[model samples]
Target: MKSNILTIMKKELARFFGDKRLVLTTLVIPGLMIYLIYSLMGSGMMSAFAPSEDQIYNVLVTSPSEEFVAAADQLKLEITEADIGDIDSIKQKLRNGEIDLYVVFPEDFDQSIASIRVGEAPDEPLELEMYYSSTEVNSSAAADIVFSYLDGLEESLSNLFNINSGSAQYDVATDEDATGMLFSMLIPMLLIMFLFSGCMAVAPESIAGEKERGTIAALLVTPLKRGDLAIGKILALSIIALLSGASSFVGTLLSLPKLMGGDMVELAGIDAGVYGVTEYLTLLVVMLTTVLVIVAIISIISAYSNSVKEATTYITPLMIVVMLVGLTSMFGNGAPTNPVLYLIPIYNSVQCMNGVFSFSGSLINTVITSVANIAYTAILVVVLKKMFDSEKIMFSK
Candidate 1:
């Protein structure tokens, strides 16, 4: 039985490595894509993080006080004051790259303060309008900064009048220094995506490829049992998935130079002590199980498929679901922390990666996730074994 298994393994391994196109799909092409992606990312990161050259903030302040106007001028902003007329045209110009921003002061802006002091309706809330290019996230941020300054000024004035007010508002951010956090989340997502794409890329060839060349019949004629044949294909497909995952990782690493930077995204919040050997082992276990689950999915579909085309069409949705699950987990920052999260297959893996990035990583969570993943992989393997046992897979036209 051992020799039969090894023999089947050797044949599948030989077929995969021996094929030139498969080799490229598994490694080279993915590597290039990763490099290109990272390089572009790096450029953007550099531009965003790098100090601005000739940093002149062009702003249009509408009906703003001389004191407010002077403050902007002191900060090296070219302040253009204009009435509310032609605001639409001004926004168009901003879009056409005519200016950086248009800052508008509220009409009856001073009266709103007076009304609030008397505890009446704020007839005019301090409307600091910042019209910037909508396409740029940076422009939106710059607008917010300017508005915040004006807001602070209003608050200070209110305080001078002893105007009792409710507590001021503030926004809490989780991504203030999210370097490694981004990477940890992105890496697992990329892994899942590449694996999915790789499965489709190789499955047709792995299954339909055999049928096309009449190799399935030849293999059947041999003493190698049907269950063993299924096992061999699963093993072969897993290798393809692994290669694809590796390619994407390489691509990501190369792209990092472009997508991020030389410093990487150094999250100050996480401590180094979290990444112990035990944590790494847990991660490895999850990764392996993840791979196995994907393999089982492919095996079931491929066995039923007459050609790779049919199998691919069948499995694309599964692939997309995996990618989506991984992405959804990344945004679960506000999700209630629980041990059950660690028991939920891919969800567990996502949380594990998140923990891996955090300062105080949870050892218990990692172990639970690992155990759950292994259990899931075992279940899938058994399911695949049953599918292989079906005589239809062996004898069907």
Candidate 2:
């Protein structure tokens, strides 16, 4: 029994790996594509967030005091004085990307600070209106720089008035929370997509390709049981799919730092210590079950189709559904606490991943999802066996 399954698995593996073109297209190309795409995206994001040194930022200031003007000059900023009435025109220019930022100071802005220094309540609270167009990268960058300047000004004013607001408070987010926020949203969706792509690449070619070439008939005529054949085919295809998925997974991990603005540890605000062996093992379990389920589904679809082209066409809708299900990780707050939700195949894997990555995954839920996936794969294998037994389905024109 083991020998028959191994023979079938070996044949499938040989057929896939023996062909250099198939191996290249199926395995090598995906990782390269992901790395290239993600790196470019990360580079673009960094560029957008950073200000260009060569480009002079146009700043429009309304009712600026001498101190404010001195600060602007000290920063080597290109400042334009505009009256309150010109605010509408300046906004229009901002929308047109003609200017980077505008700052409006209330008349007697310095007088308010002076009043506070003398222990007198100002007639009105000090206010400043700053505007920038977010759609323009330069405008946004300029706005960030201006915000830093204003923060410094605020600190200086507070010190001058001897206003002690206790000790400084730092960011309240913990390392786990930061890491969880970064990985939970991205990793689950990426894993599902890679697994599905891997299965899609090989499953149809294994089953439908054989059927289309009439090779399945020869195999059926042999002493192998139809159930064994189905199991062997599913297992072989799962191995290949797992390899493909792993390739893409590695690519994603390697490129994620660049994707998240080039500093993974800094960006996640956590060290590798955050995810211990337990989390990795949980992730591995989720990935293994996910590949099995995906491969089984694709195998069943492939068996039903008369040709590889037809199989791919039939599987396209399933791919779409997988992608849609993967998106749940992005919008979802975290893994749902309800155990019943863990029974939903692809969605369950996604949630399990989210939970595991966030360090909040339920072991019971993970176990349920894994068991449910295996159960579903078993059902698919049985259906595939029936399809194999049906001469009409196997040899249909």
Clashing pairs in 2: none
Q: How many Å off is the CA of 95 in candidate 2?
A: 4.6
- What TM-score, to 2 decimals, does candidate 2 have? 0.84
What TM-score would every model get versus the actual structure? 0.66, 0.84
Residue 30 error for model 1, in Å? Answer: 2.4
Instruction: Give Cα distance to truth, residue 59, candidate 2, Å.
Output: 3.0
Question: Which candidate should be chosen as best, given TM-score against the real structure?
Answer: 2
> What ranges in model 1 sit over 4 Å off?
38-52, 55-95, 101-187, 253-277, 331-348, 358-391
How do the residues 84-165 of candidate 1 rate in per-residue lDDT, one tens digit apiece?
8887798787777667678776766666666666777564445566678756544554566576777787676565554435
On a 0 to 100 scale, what is the lDDT of residue 129 in model 2? Answer: 92
Per-residue lDDT of 1-397 in model 2, one digit per residue for the tens?
Answer: 5888889989999999999999998899898888889888988888877766776688888888667778775565688998877677888999998988899988887887677667776766688999999989888877887888877777665665544466864668888888888789888998899999999999999999999999999999999988889989888888888888888988888777787765656855854458988999999888898898999999988999999999999999999999999989888688999999999999999999999888778999999999999999999889999999998899889
